[model samples]
Target: MGIGEGEPHPAGSGSSSVEVVDVLRRGELVVLGRIPSASNATLVCDVVLDDVELRCVYKPVRGEVPLWDFPDGTLAGREVASYLISDALGWGVIPETVLRDGPVGFGMVQRWVDTPDNTDRPHPSAPSELPDGRVDLVDLCPPGAVPVGYRAVLRAFDSIGEPVVLVHADDPRLQRMAVLDVILNNADRKGGHVLEGLDGGVYGIDHGICLHSEDKLRTVLWGWAGETVPAHLVADLADLARRLESPDDDLRSDLAEHITGDEIDALALRTLVIAETTAMPLPPGHRPIPWPPF
Candidate 1:
């Protein structure tokens, strides 16, 4: 139930909520003291039972719905997939608890993850340094530690790995992740949210904006356009694409029980979107970045 040093939390595993959004149906929790609604969807608090070491996420009634719109109370089905993936890959996924009764109908509560070394703590989307230059301040989602960062992840998918982000056209792993994001319609791929594990793995966060009926990818990675696809890597993506559409692949939605029929359709559509356009130019008039910074 608790995480210790040198061990990563398991995927699709985390504390669950004892309540839903309807109870507070008309309001929010004010007991979490001076919580900020400005930076990161969460404002740091001691809502969950734990010391400064436990990872905790605060939901402000209005903050919960975005994590995965599952009618308000039930844990998000889509997010659990991310949890499973992150856990399987080995990293923090920030387990959640919802507090209800507000605009969005739910808020989150979970453990607090440590900020990576030589860097500031991270918000759900952007990683930022603390005010006093100390390490423990509530910070934004931090960026990856390039060169040394993702070394493990890159090595895992080495046959298809490219030296850069945007130009990694042939990277099957990234392509698969991209496909997953497209299917889920994830919009919080901001630099800080994506982490390069100390063990060289790749992990991401912020599932609130996922599973939309449209393309919502808005991250700050990918160095350029028209990046070339490595043929071998493309073969891997083609395999995943094929596997995704296969109805027999129960494992596809297994880890995450919150997924719906429509969400599945959205996932298939993601592959189509990419297949139709290899370059996949940014759609017109979309800022791609979420407002309010939270």
Candidate 2:
């Protein structure tokens, strides 16, 4: 049968979460092209179902290069697990994802989110140090441009040696995603992995290097460090901790199918610590942010 043989709207259309999962699990995958910049081999594809056409990214097991830290042939599985964690917490930060046999072999297939234009929003201008020996906003306005009190948390230089301010994690969407990264123990939460959808939803992706048993939570979202975690978020973490320890929980069983038992236990431990502290984690000091920020 031809791809998307019976669709009026694209893949998601108005489908429920269950329907979306079903389509991702059983739809026809048509590879459109390769995403060359990804560390692992990644493909942009169309998931064609009887009544929907969904854009997706496909990462096959065979395409993964060996990593000394994480087990071989398990990155795709981690990607699916990340989606499950995001869903369980009701954060809605990760796109719908599933694992199935594709053209290359068993791998991860995730819904592709489209980023909307954010030209009207404030963006980074430049960075400078403060009198207190801390780095923060120097100025945001361009020459005579109107100032909006945008604080610069991090700083980097542009292609021609001009400075560019970095994103402040104070943005609500970003703050949520950053907390999710801490829960997942994401070791590679790059700026590019954060997506702003056309519907104004923000999502985090590229979770292949996450959920380690060790304390490897390196990221670019340090703006909330040393701050109190909101009480509601603490409650959510408590719920997650309970779910991780429950024997009959579906999410626990699902994660076991993809990752090691030790890693799951580590997740439980991490959840408890986060809830107990109720504060953003402090940097480990010495090279916490990933290189090539974007």
Candidate 3:
């Protein structure tokens, strides 16, 4: 069956946020198949609750690949934490996600996003002759020929030793996602993780390795580094900072369930720093970008 078949309700399809959360929380889950490309055991599933049915990605805690830096089996909770942070900021960059019991055990279930088909277009990592025709978030173009409305991030040689430049669209939607990544301390923002939904929404997914205590903001979206954060986003960040400062704030209490107290404090600090500066950050550390960017 195709992704989200059988009249699956697409996210942002006029369903109230509360209603969507209720369906995901109460739905009976059936594993459809495994997404082989994922490093973890990511399962595509059909979630049903009475007449409402939705397609979702399920990542059971038992299926998580252990990481030395992060505590074991916490990736599922991190995924949910990332969604909470995104929702609190009112950016809606991440799809609706919740942590609950699934077929395999406790895991994260996120609404599946349907991206635009770009199979015929050149892969984002390979140099594209038609830069203007690019539909994805990241692209490679001939050096010194960056497409209009695109920002050049790096100039390097391709596999055949031909010079090329890495670039991403200078889109407001993408810019907002970049800011959200900064707030979440997202360690992996590969080009492939960015999606343009059919509903005219730009989304970021695969947030299993995010919201660490340290500064590990690796991504391919450094196109706007050192630039001023948009005024609206700055305002939102300021609001989020205020909420995080409250000990009994619902957002803070919800996030506390997933991440450690230190990690939450780190999150609050990151939000405050950006809100105060209102400037986009230049990448820190030697390994600022993720390998195989697409």
Candidate 4:
């Protein structure tokens, strides 16, 4: 069906992960609308199976904008790869994402997360601030007024030259996401990408520019820098490292389809470093945080 032609489908609720993946992989996609502010063409769609329908985000490869640092049309694959890694790590940080054919073309389709403040189809001008005092991983505060459970990352001025401090929550869920970003070499982890689901789960999204072989880790989640990685997370990293060691390993083989062998090797190396060192690495490179840090 044509874009904007269908009634908004309430996103399916309480589906198992396997069911979500199946619907995303085999369902018929009907475009509801476009996420106008997205750098790439991002469509909010309804994926319909025989008796189930779910809202999902579809990023078609044909709509990808070429980037100098990343190869063309690979962003969709990278998104799926990020989901694979998150699934393997048993973190569920990223939503259920799959690369599949849609109305536009082949692309990455991810289950839509229902957040407390967002509607079925989010608009370009949707409020960035979470309602009900729900804390975001990254936030801005007046200089020297950092919240009790937050870590100050950068001190700067806002557009009107008002002093502000960039900070992130000290919650462990966000810390796990930071570690995942390190292993994925995620180039963009803007504050807006972190979502607080209505189901009380914290999720990270927009992982199109991840899994690069280089040290392109740019994020607003520097709160845990220089701290020892939590023992439970380190053990998970160690498990991931072991899975990536063998050529016949399922995770390694699955990753090789989306990213290069060198990139997968780099992922393995990063996982091993964190698993062994058990410490969060300090920000590397001149620009450690992404521009506009949201």
Write down the RMSD of all candidates, one decimal each: 11.2, 7.1, 4.2, 3.3
Candidate 1 lDDT by residue in tens digits, 1-294: 355764333322223222221212222232433334333345553332222123344544444443343355333334555554333322233333333332333454433344354235333445454355432211222234232222111111122453322212223434445444544467665544544334333445556556655556664433322444444434444455565577787545653255566665666666455555554334225655443222
| Alpha carbon lDDT at 27, candidate 4 | 87
Say which candidate scores most in lDDT: 4
Residue-level lDDT of model 4, residues 171-206, one tens digit each, is 888899999999999999999899878787789999
Global CA lDDT computed for model 3 = 0.86
Against the reference, the lDDT scores of all candidates come to 0.41, 0.79, 0.86, 0.88
Model 4 regions lying over 4 Å from their true place: 1-13, 120-135
Write candidate 3's Cα lDDT for 1-294 as tens digits: 233546445344888777788888899998877877789988888788766778788999999998988889899899999999999888889999999999889999998776556324333223324355664568788987888899988787888999988899999999999999998899999988998887788999999889999988999999999999999999999999999999989999999999998999999999999999999999886988988787
How do all models score by TM-score?
0.49, 0.85, 0.90, 0.93
Which regions of candidate 1 are displaced past 4 Å?
A: 1-75, 83-180, 229-233, 253-256, 275-277, 292-294
- As for lDDT, the candidate ahead, 1 or 2, is 2
> Per-residue error at 45 for model 2, in Å?
0.7
lDDT of candidate model 1 versus the reference: 0.41
Instruction: Quantify how close model 3 is to the true structure by its C-alpha RMSD in Å.
Output: 4.2
